[model samples]
Target: MNTETGVTAQTRPSATSSEGPDAHSAPPTRGQMWRHLGPGIVVAATGVGAGDLVATLIAGSRFGYALLWAAVVGCIVKIALSEGSARYHLATGSTILAGWRSLGKWTSWYFGVYVIIWGFIYGATAMSATALPLTALFPELPLRAWAIIAGIFGFVFVWFNRYETFEIVMKILVGLMFIIMVGLAFLVAPSLPDMARGMTFELPEGSLFYTLGLIGGVGGTITTAAYGYWTQAKGWRGMPWFPMMRVDNALAYIVTGIFVIAMLIVGAELLYSAGIALEDSDKGLLGLSGVLEERFGATIATLFLVGFAATSLSSLLGVWQGMSLFFSDWWYQLRGASEGGHEGSGAYKFYLAWLTFPPMILLFADRPFLLVIIYGAFGALFMPFLAVTLLMLNNSERVPAHARNGVVANLTLAGSAILFVVLAVQQVARLLS
Candidate 1:
């Protein structure tokens, strides 16, 4: 039951037989497994958008190194959830939506409403986020103009490209983002002793919300749920693919952990010691750019802005692609299509258009109050919903006995569910009030 890899009835060949590596004949070597690391990179790039960076920056500005431990713990918690998602897919050779469907019609109802509404709201949000640094860098255009251009760019790119092209572009963007963020952290030269002290568990005064936000916000989003679909897109399909999938998931989040910790270091060394405060929004990253210009110079500030654009655009591209894949699968499954929807399908294009067009209206004017309320309520519950559903699906008989959740996996996922539930309650309360 505890073995790392084995095949079962649920395991099947990839849909496009040429996509995945040949893992069935013999166990893949470390080098071979590393070559197959695409989906995890996609997930990581998609998950860490501009908003996540701002949240971490704010946490570091407010609490210094005090909540560093929470950020690391957040990564671990997400690792558990994402691993469970990929594990179910590999062990059962089914999509997560299919797993949700097996649970009951209630799952479909929740997802159908959630994905559509989430797409509409998040489209505007993602476009605005991607546009910020661009507007900051090139001020001739208004923020709204840059946002629309960004949305169109993402829509065109995803609409025309396949998964292979998408993955390659994502890797390039992720690499650029990694270099810029980690480079800035090094430029600041953080104190080693203070960082070490931050590793010990201690929350400063008035730090509870910031601490929770850090733990909950680091490199996680609905993108975590899209991970299994990504694995399938990469053509990994069974128990034989399990070991490689685990490695990919862990490494991606490890990169995410480093990326987030770098931002925290920037906040701690550059802002906290000086008592600088950043606005608690995506625009706050632009505030950091100003700080960078003052201290480092125009060149470094421009570099930071470019990195910011990379971060934001990568997220926009990822959601446009990954969520569209998810929406297509869910719709086709609901209609009982034997051969499920794929890229370039009608449902897929509809979602891509849906994500790109309808939300553009919100950019021109304020988001409607009622729609905002509904989006917040549903969005807040999504993480908890994912955590809970994974618990039910993975522990039940749908998965093979050998690939079921171990004790550590169970505890970590259970903890994630509780954490997200708390966050959801707070978010809903804040939104309604």
Candidate 2:
């Protein structure tokens, strides 16, 4: 992995060298799998936060497997969008923030405003989501207490560890959640015919909103923009690393797509089959855990809850780390200090603090509605911001000819932009209403 320029360096053999022993060496082994699996894990873990789970469960409960296809499509959209961002970083040797900054100062201003508003709102949401399971398991503690603990824990982890340690921890959490959640899906034995029909992509009656949400919700967020930073941390840069980066990204989302679909299967088979409807909150997950306990016994249910907790915790940590990095860069650029001694400065810690602490005010506020609304509005717009920008940046002359956006890439990104705009409109309407 080359870290100098953001582009991945190519490793393809020349046509004449294809027949050599080096070229014919045995294929990469299982042990080598770990090397290529890093970025995917981070992307998936970041994308599959608590909000995604709630959306999937709600869709399953309302329409069974009808929306599974949308979930898969969402994963494809994410791969295209995230890959585009990563490719830009790998090809340009610059951060996404730098790319956006190059476009114009307005790009920087929009991101700055969005991140501050988004982080404060998201901090409370992530803490509350993590607190739900903890409060359920230990009813003696207040939810506020649990939320504070979760927030502080996330803050400590991101503050203490550097990128490498953070990646390893998140990978473990992702593995645990993937195994338990997917394992539970198999145990419930989903209906193949129903799943196949879902693959056909027809929207069921009264499910237009659900379908849109599923398409917009699958493993996506502001964290998608963080792909380049993570790639830099992995020492991956230049076009030589492009093949491996693509493979890493594709495999990551493949796992994420499977994980989300498996959850939908669980919802369809376990909850929907039993006529269970989950609420639009993390508490809904606790209710589902109760159903799991009743059907599969206490042990399986406990495992599922643990996985749920890990997912929420990992997300908390990820947002704290990734968003802080984004905010710090934007802040420095805002001060017109694009170069000099301020590059890669220590300002990220301040943003991390902002994410962890200020939101606690909402945890105890008399009314939390305004905070939630502001958060949702900004959060809704971020995907479109990323998609539209990537389309513009990757196709611009700033990128080298070899790495410029081709027709297929442009089409995919355009579709993503359209889809995200629709979702963002719906989200705003919901907030205003």
Q: lDDT winner among the candidates?
A: 1
**For residues 1-433, could you state the per-residue lDDT of candidate 1 as single tens digits?**
2111122223422222235333333446788877778888999999998878988899899888888998899899888888998898788876787788777778988999888989999999889999999998889999999999999999999989888889999999999999999999999998889988999989899888777777776786688988887887777777887888899999999999999999999999999999999988788898999999999999999999999999999999999998998898777767765444577777889999999999999987764555545655667689999999999999998888999999999899899899889988987887878
- Predicted structure 1: lDDT: 0.85
Local distance difference test, each candidate? 0.85, 0.78
Question: Mind giving the per-residue lDDT tens digits that candidate 2 earns over 1-433?
Answer: 4322232223311101112111222323455645556867887887887778888988898889888889988888888888898899778766677678777778888998788888888999899989987887788999999999999998888888767677889999999999988998999998888899988887889998878877777686788878766766666666776776778888888988888998898888888878988877667898888899899899988888888888888788878877776776566555544332111345677888889999998899877766766676668799999999999899987789999988988999999899989989988888888
**Which residue ranges in model 2 land beyond 4 Å of their true spot?**
1-33, 336-344, 366-370
Error of 2 at 316 (Å): 0.7
